[model samples]
Target: MSSHAPPARTHLLIASLCLLGLLSTTGASLPYPILAPLFAGDVGNGLSAFLGLPPKLLLGIALMVNPLGLLIGSAVLGAVSDRLGRRRILLATAIGAAAGHALTAAALVAESYPLFLLARFVTGLLEGNGAIMRAMVVERVEGPLRNHALSWLNGAFHLGWLVGPLLAGFTVGVSITLPFTIAAGALLVGALLAASALERGTAAAKAGERWWRVARERHAFTLLRHAPLRTLFSVHFAYACGVAAFYEFFPLWLVDVGGYAVREIAFVNMGMCALMTGAALFAGRASSTEPRRRASIQAGLAALSILAVGFGSLGVGLAAIVLFGLPHAYYNATVQGWAADQFAGYGQGAVMGLLSTTFCLANIVMALAGGALALVDTRIVLVLGGALALWAALAMRNWSRRAVSVAAQAVELR
Candidate 1:
């Protein structure tokens, strides 16, 4: 079936998948620009009063819920997509995400904190299409083209991050509830595009294999049992922890410490996103070798750590944030490429699901920890996150050396 398709159709399929990724990321990030001020009783027409909880605590819970949902969704839907087919999962989840976003908007308008949290959770759960979409990309393309396709998808995600906050900033000025609605509409568009463009590939199930059993068999926990895969997952988890912490609280710091407005935050993020996109593209082209990829990852981690510590002066800090983008892009592209090479045989959906679970778990920890630390000093959270990234960089270096030694010994024996 795939062989007979026109090149145009294939290109359309890839474009649609990338668009879906962009929309999903944009929807996921749409709430961030205003969340701090809105929940802190500083914006959104006193929305925080309805929650009757401390702003930091409420914000923490709100942030934590999404990753919790992502953890479950990535584990469950990612595995399920393997059995049920990627197209179907993508279709369903995209629609579900739209609904969740609508609900979030309604909750905001009605000032219902619990409803808002539930909506965010639902959105995260349904956004598991990331893994499914990645699997679809893998199924449709192969060889160098596959890597390029994945890089484009990653770029799409960064592009979304670039645009989402900017849209939120504009919309919030008009109406705080508007961004959610806009995100919902965009996701709906993605769903329609997926429904039209995506082709269902071979399902992962064998004859008489129950769906639940298949999901359990491909669980992220099962993947962790492999030594090399485990090492990779650990490194990814550590990096994600730091990134999540830095991202979630960085806005809060900007508002509280740097005295920046939402528009200014958006502008800074736009610069970061631009750099990130450039870095992703450069990494895709330049870091093709294993040794180079490892070096890129190490260098990125070190730069990230240094940048986190240098956020005292707002101007300097914003510059650091922008510069941090290069390393950020390098680490993400390198590690993701390495993981793809390592896990291509285990079912792309399953592998991506496991990776998503690792990311979500890290986000959950950092969200809570960052929030608590913010009460004392936001700088502490940033420092701790930097320390974690540095540790992971050191750990990856050691692991790489051991892997090289083992390979060398195997070569000698052969």
Candidate 2:
């Protein structure tokens, strides 16, 4: 290896983490496709009687548990990485995720509901791979390249949601045990890669703020209080609620009401995701060209898309969902870039930790409410989701305008 090869190791490290992040996320997702089948099987049927609960309720319990794990994990683990160094935490969490998957596989084989929940919850808690990988990208890169990296990272997440089930389908014919086992194995490989591939860094050695204490930093909150960030967070958070509602309930609606098979729904979801991935590529280009313009176009598209969904057009629904998601992912990536610009002196790992915290809180609130709303009517779910998007579009318009005004003020002061 050349003298300059260490940094190249960093690159390899990040790439490995990104793929592992994708697999971890995708593996956690595999349960979604198998939920109904598991429910119908002898194991699930027996548990339903023993527990005196509907299978859907059990499935929802398991499905929702992971996101809750994720919301908490993203914050806690992201902060841990900030303090403990990304490498150690990344390795530990990847292993923990592997354990979670193994537990999940064992739970399936043993037909243990409590073990199943514990495994899924633990896996959810270890879901820090996404945030960590993104932070790693931010840590390892600078300037325009950083922006590109975040865009690509965001795309990987979208891609994971798309591919998770397709990969799971291969095992569906053999046995549910196979998919969970594969998931666990993927995570194990990820752990090994993370341990061997990443270079040693000293960020962990510098005694900085504790994970919770980081919230109290003036600069951290100042970044949050900044006019552009304030508006950006609001628009992003509100639109994200709608996005949350869709992801939470759409598949359930199709499978329960539309009478679609689990595999069919996964394919439909894959279609939407493929479209989203394509749109993200385009939106990233627009963001690079002019962020504010791109945000405006995204907001407008989101507004129009929500309106389409409200009209109950599945075609329109699919189209709108993709349009909204594609731009939103780009918008978040650009916001992360802007954050790097505004907080240039700050620790990226810590700053992203806070951002992830804020996002988790937002998702938690929306998901709980969204899940409750699903009990009423799927249309209510769609309407509320659309409404949030529409509101976000309006907020983005004002947000962009305010951002320009603030920049002008800074220039004048200078």
Candidate 3:
């Protein structure tokens, strides 16, 4: 690690970065609580009808656009960050996100669906800062500190989910565009914090290397050639598929099946967030042994599958939401810890970007799929999501055991 700054300064910087993570997710989630009403023509003075598209289709398109942008942005900018530097890229992305959110607010007020979509796309493109931030945390810390930092970052995400919708649920009642405007202002503040507080890190690219060469060399696709990394990537992708489906459709299911109001849904989300936050903090102190981590991940997946099944009962559904938080937090922290280990000497930006890309791609697929399925029956989407998680857990367990056995045999031969 570089020379440590004063304790106070270091703490402040860590806090600011965590806040940035929180703010980023807050902005991203601000639209979800209100999307149903906004696009269904129930809110915003028939805005959905004015757009001349089916409400469900428009909702899917809107949901999908951000991830599509993220997919492209993380792939390109993540590689660029490795060539350039983390702090510089983070600052730029923060500023861009601020502008993008402002544009979205304007587009909403103007009742232009196209502009709104464009704004969301732009914001998502800049939102790849998350990859940079993750890389930064890994670069700055070591050992248990690194694990804690990762946990804190993940907690920030769930906390943002908690606060964003609650804020939207309340503010959206006053003005349909209020939440976006608030998000824009918050992002601007995050940009300022990042600019003033963040320190520069060593660039991943060799000195004098060309950008294209760096990009070509660090291509995430190339990582697949390494068997262990490939296994990790596959497991990450599979796990994300189920998570994406659950998040994309749960709100819709609650509204359609259980007759939840926006504020009520927000309250339930708060419970989920609380559980996630607790789990994240807990994971930071828990053992970081590989076996324990893998077991935690598997257990989380199994619990998630059960949660999906429980969605059929209202009381059970709410309980499941709360219960799912621990596994979610454990799975996230463990996977991230593993990824950090894999990319220790490699380009953090590029590798994390690839992971983010996997996540975004999953989101795009699940969002569209969930939307289509909702028209038929929203519960079906949840059931399918559960099945996917169960399958992924089984596959991951098998692969993990095989890896262990191979290692044991190799040790005996040596």
Pick the winner on lDDT between candidates 2 and 3.
3
Write model 1 residue lDDT over 1-414, tens digit each, in one string. Answer: 122235677678879988888998888878876787777754544356654667777876786787678788888777787677777778988999999989998988888888988999999888866777766766676555666667777878889877777788778888877888888898898788778886666664678887677666776667778877787777778777877777777777788777887678777878888888876665655443564247446555544644554355776667777777777766665666566667777767778788778878888788778878889988778777777776777777777777778889999999
Relative to the true structure, candidate 1 reaches a TM of 0.87
TM values, all candidates: 0.87, 0.84, 0.88
lDDT of 2 by residue, 1-414 (tens): 011235567567657766776787687677766776677656534544447787777776877788788766766665556656777877888888888888887887777888888888888888755666767777676545566667766776778777777777777789868887887888888778777877655654346556455423432334565665566567767777766666666666665555777667767777778766666554434243445555556655655565565555566565665566665666667667766566545456545655665666666776778768878777677678768867876766666677778889999999
lDDT, each prediction: 0.75, 0.67, 0.74
**Candidate 2: regions farther than 4 A off:** 1-11, 40-46, 205-232, 252-263, 281-283, 286-293, 344-346, 357-363
- Best-performing candidate as measured by TM-score: 3
Worst ten in a row by lDDT for model 3:
288-297
lDDT (Cα, tens digit) per residue for candidate 3, span 187-248: 88887977788776666556687756765776556667877768766777766777777777
As a TM-score, model 2 comes out at: 0.84
C-alpha lDDT of candidate 1 relative to the true structure? 0.75
